[model samples]
Target: MLWVKAFHILFVVSWFSGLFYLPRIFVNLALEKESVSRERLLLMARKLYRFMMMLSVPAVLLGAWLLWLQYGGSGSFKMPGWMHAKLTLVILAIGYSHACGAILKKFERGANTRSHTWYRWFNEVPVLMLLAIIILVVVKPF
Candidate 1:
């Protein structure tokens, strides 16, 4: 169970690495306004997004399972305030991911230029979310 938790953390970290970087790439892609560069950036964003989807969802599920294990997988699992906050942030992170997917679909339809400002703003979303997640996980700040 500890091993599973460790692996979940590893995957989460890896997924977050992509999450932090991909939006910056999207920003660059939006700024470039060049066909070739945009194509490359879009390709990179798509690939990184796919990797994040493959990694983070299962990692989150495993983390949830580990939380369940803390209470022996029964309804007796008492969550701290910070854990609840962390869960809210996790759900928000998932929402941001869905937003990214929507942006990707727009990109696929050549609507990328219209979403430049939103993409730039999206670049900052994960940083704050990651901060909250780290605080919740480490300091358990309620």
Candidate 2:
């Protein structure tokens, strides 16, 4: 279980590295006017998204494993309010990740209508999510 928790932390950190970076790429992508620069940014965004998604799979699986270990399965598990809130925030974070992928596609197709300002705000979503998640887990303030 200790090993599981450690690996979960490792993979979560890996996923977060992408969550922190890909949006900055979007900000640069939005600002880039040169074809060469745009193409490079697109390539970086695509690779980072793929790598981050790979990390997320392990993170999610390990996290679920920990949860199951903590609470057991099915009706045996009783969730605290803090855990519920943490999960809701996690769902929001996943939605944001999907939104980033969609936005990345729009950038790739040169169909982006959003300004760099939009992406700058968009970049803050994960930061807020991370903060809330950490607080929920550490404080468990229900």
Quick one: best lDDT, which candidate?
Answer: 2
lDDT by residue (82-137, candidate 2, tens digit) is 99998898788778878889999999889999899988998998999999999999
Runs in model 2 lying further than 4 Å from the true structure: 73-75
Q: Each model's C-alpha lDDT?
A: 0.82, 0.91
TM-score against native, each model: 0.88, 0.96
Query: Number of the top candidate by TM-score?
Result: 2
Model 1 pairs whose backbones collide: none
Clashes of 1: 0
Give the CA lDDT, 0 to 100, for residue 107 in model 2.
94
- Write down the RMSD of candidate 2 (Cα, Å): 1.1
Candidate 2 achieves a global lDDT of 0.91
Candidate 1 structure quality by residue, lDDT tens digits, 1-142? 8898888889888878887888787777767768898889888989999998888888788887888787646778777899889889988888888777887777767777655576778888898998989988899776
TM-score, candidate 1, is 0.88
